[model samples]
Target: MTWLITGGAGYIGAHVVRAMTGAGERTVVYDDLSTGDAGRVPREVPLVVGSVLDGGRLARAIAAHQVTGVVHLAAKKQVGESVGRPLHYYHENVEGLRVLLEAVTAAPVTAFVFSSSAAVYGMPDVDVVTEETPCRPLSPYGETKLAGEWLVRAAGRAAGLATASLRYFNVAGAATPALADTGVSNLVPMVFHRLTEGTAPRVFGDDYPTADGTCVRDYIHVVDLAEAHVTVARALRSTPGLDLTLNVGRGEGVSVREMIDRINAVTGYDHPPTIAPRRPGDPARVVASADRIATELGWRAAHDVQDMITSAWEGWVRLHPAAARA
Candidate 1:
């Protein structure tokens, strides 16, 4: 069966594309290249350079590729930017999904997988969030993701299309040998950038309710996260009744200070991290249970914090070797 991976050249999408290709499955990539790199995609895979906002282009690609399934990963995902530009987030994230859904209906695709975010849970009173957690997003990014999930569910129910929305936490590290050159948004890469510049990386917030009094987040390695997508695709093909949203995380939270310390240890940097005030709308702690995906899809995160940091540091160094020195 052929699959359509929107934003397949992006950070997470590129990894998913590689995983699908490695599994000996037919795959096609659709990306606008706003933040994705064309070189990240494999030469063998068919690349359709187009936007999901363009219905005609999307329809043409879907039909031309004869794609039976779709993994929608294209979206504007930045908490700070979303807060500053709510309209743009809604327009791109929400409208883009609408246009894609329209195309899926026109083409009558069988299964769809949505790349969702844990931001939908916001700052839950409890540290660990389950799939049943009430969604009260603190930022426009989270709000649009929640809205996207709703749209997917509604459209699925109406169209008899099997859907799975994977609500992932902070995805870090590089999956393949190829490194990303632009639009690296995760904390690890940002820290690597500062460390290479001979400047101490800044840690936001040092006084939270967590063990280290710093904000805590669950970070899953990008390769493990991509594997979860493949598992979802397999489940869609095997069990048609599996239509639900599942959280993909390591079921643990690491503080910002702890992450910095790990980076320092891995990079052997003597300089300390610069502690900064917490940004507005920052959550205290957010973790995921991930029991559902484990029990249902037989999936679990394989990489730990060390693996995440090490792999990410290697990719950063490969891209900017000058940053690797003291």
Candidate 2:
């Protein structure tokens, strides 16, 4: 089963490509390099550089690689930025995906995996979010993912294809320092950057109802998340007409204050964080149930919060040697 991975050179996407290939799966990478790094693609894997919006390029990549499966991971993901440029996000995430679906359905590909997000369940009220959780996305980025899932599932049913939508929570750490997530969009990297600059990391807010009165989130290790993709891919290959939607998370909610404390202990920066007003779209608590993925693929996260901080700090220090001195 030859698999084509879009955005394969990105932080999470890179991990997926490595894990897929390591499992003896035939894989090809398709990335536009807008937010991806070409250097991250392995020499053994063929890299096709083109946007998913380009239907012709996607069709060529699928046909040239003889791809039988696809894992779509390319999209605009920042919440704030999506708010500012809703049209751009829709064009990239929604329209780009529509173009991809057209190509895959026209080809012989039968298995598809979408890189979804917890943002699809914006401000989930439940203690542990499940696959059946109602989706009320807050940002344009999240809305695109939710819409993409519907589109993928519908297309799969019509074309007799197997598909899975994996909604990931907060992802951190790296398999190696060079492959670490360099973007400062997520929490861990943001904290690393703040401490590296000898400034106190800013906790968005501390007035929430939870313990420590800070926003709580579920964190998942990048390595484990990648492995889940491999399992899902294999499952799709074996199960005909399989349409699965699962959450990828540790099922534990770590408060903002708790994460900051751990980051300080791991990095030795130990700077006190200053509290600011809550961001507009920030959720109070959104932990995953994780039971569906476990039952479906027998997969559970092996790494914890400490593991995330240690590996991420190593990568941060690599990019900014001055971080180690702090």
Please, what are the lDDT tens digits per residue for candidate 1 over residues 30-82?
A: 99999999999899999999999999999999999899899999999989889
Best TM-score goes to which candidate? 2
Candidate 2 per-residue lDDT over residues 10-56, each given as its tens digit: 99999999999999999999999999999999999999999999999
What value of lDDT does candidate 1 attain over all alpha carbons? 0.89
lDDT agreement with native, every candidate: 0.89, 0.93
By TM-score, how accurate is candidate 1?
0.97
lDDT of 1 at 295: 97
How high is each candidate's TM-score? Answer: 0.97, 0.98
The alpha-carbon root-mean-square deviation between model 1 and the true structure, to one decimal in Å, is 1.3
